[model samples]
Target: MRDQTDTGTTEPIPSRLLLGYARVSTDDQDLTNQRAELHEAGCTKIFSEKITGTRRDRPELARMLDHLRPGDIVTVTRLDRLARSTRDLLDIAEHIQSGGAGLRSLAEPWADTTTPAGRMVMTVFAGIAEFERSLIVERTRSGRVAAKARGVKFGPRPTL
Candidate 1:
């Protein structure tokens, strides 16, 4: 008769438990849905932030990063919640990758750094973000030039 269970001959599926991070710019935004989504996505632990993403200090995000260990996975409902700027997003991604962890974005289904295609997508996003920044800089310059042409002061006025 064959044994019903394996005699310690089976391999584990590499515990890929998900860790969730959620953020909202203002208190007005509801976090109920975000928490539910993270739970549904298999998040054993969820870290939430209620402050603006533009701020240099995000206590929840900081705590999440510190808590993460190698071979773990971090998830977010959307990328914007994690980072507001392209540079910030890229920085965070790099940090996660360095820690031997992967990032998954629920909203951006294509953003799964665990696959080759996902890495490609991230590279493309970096390029697009750089282009967007350049365009903004150019537009600002043009606007300033137009304003000056209309006799608008660029700086504080001199006292008489």
Candidate 2:
């Protein structure tokens, strides 16, 4: 015979489980590899998405974040998978930090936000990402100026 216990007698849930998030920019990009890696990393639940990184809102990502609890870990294949810009990345990091959850990047193990060292590495990465964006903007501006000087007409042609 089996003994019965009160509702509070059940085993407590494991709080350190891994929650994986896999994202691809286009339909052509596959999530197979990322899923496999995340599974191997011991992810109990995996959230996936096929959408542009430039889009500020991602349904799967939001669902994943909502599912996360304190002490739970969020895993991704890469830092870029989490965000397209440094600001977005920082925002996500802040959210995780405030929620008492941890962020882990499989490709970039240094991005684990569970440790002090990981925070430092992410800080540097954020700075570099911002610098790269600035460089791209500057180059685009210079190219537009040069094209204008050369009388290279830009934009669409006017209809007759």
Candidate 3:
């Protein structure tokens, strides 16, 4: 995204942008502290929402992701406020990376993808999360197989 001048000139956009994202699980929750923290962190724009993290469709979050540009950093008050699970976080992080932006959590420095070390840490975490998910799936399959062998049934109960 380039900035255009009045004289028909085009220049690269701002050196960088610290775009903040604040979320609360419910409407009754307050966003004051998150907003203040982001402002103090030099964020020029902030996107906020009052929705559960478990929901995949978040309007404000989607808007923020769409607004991302190269050299933009998405800041969150905490990782849990952005995603409910590791896979969710990784998916959102992948989207941000694909948009040429970075992600940073104020409360979890290890989750930042702007720095080399932080990126490595996140990569390692992603790998671990994937392995854990695979293990869980395997265990579930095995459990189901064993249950079926014992004459245990699955699915909803029969209707009249």
Task: Order the candidates by lDDT, highest first.
Answer: 3, 2, 1
lDDT of 1 by residue, 57-102 (tens): 9999999989878778899999999987778998898899898888
Candidate 3 off by > 4 Å = 1-14, 155-160
Clashing pairs in 1: none
Best by the lDDT measure: 3
Choose 1 or 2, whichever is better by TM-score.
Answer: 1
- How many clashes in candidate 1? 0
lDDT head-to-head 1 vs 2, winner: 2
Off by over 4 Å in 1: 1-14, 130-160
Give the alpha carbon lDDT tens digit for every residue of 26-144 in model 3.
Answer: 88899999999999999999999899888889999999999999889999889998888988889899999988899999999988899998899889989999999999999999999
The alpha-carbon deviation from the true structure for residue 16 of candidate 2, after best TM-score superposition, in angstroms, is 1.2
| Models ranked on TM-score | 3, 1, 2
What is the clash count of model 3?
Answer: 0
TM-score of candidate 1 relative to the true fold: 0.73
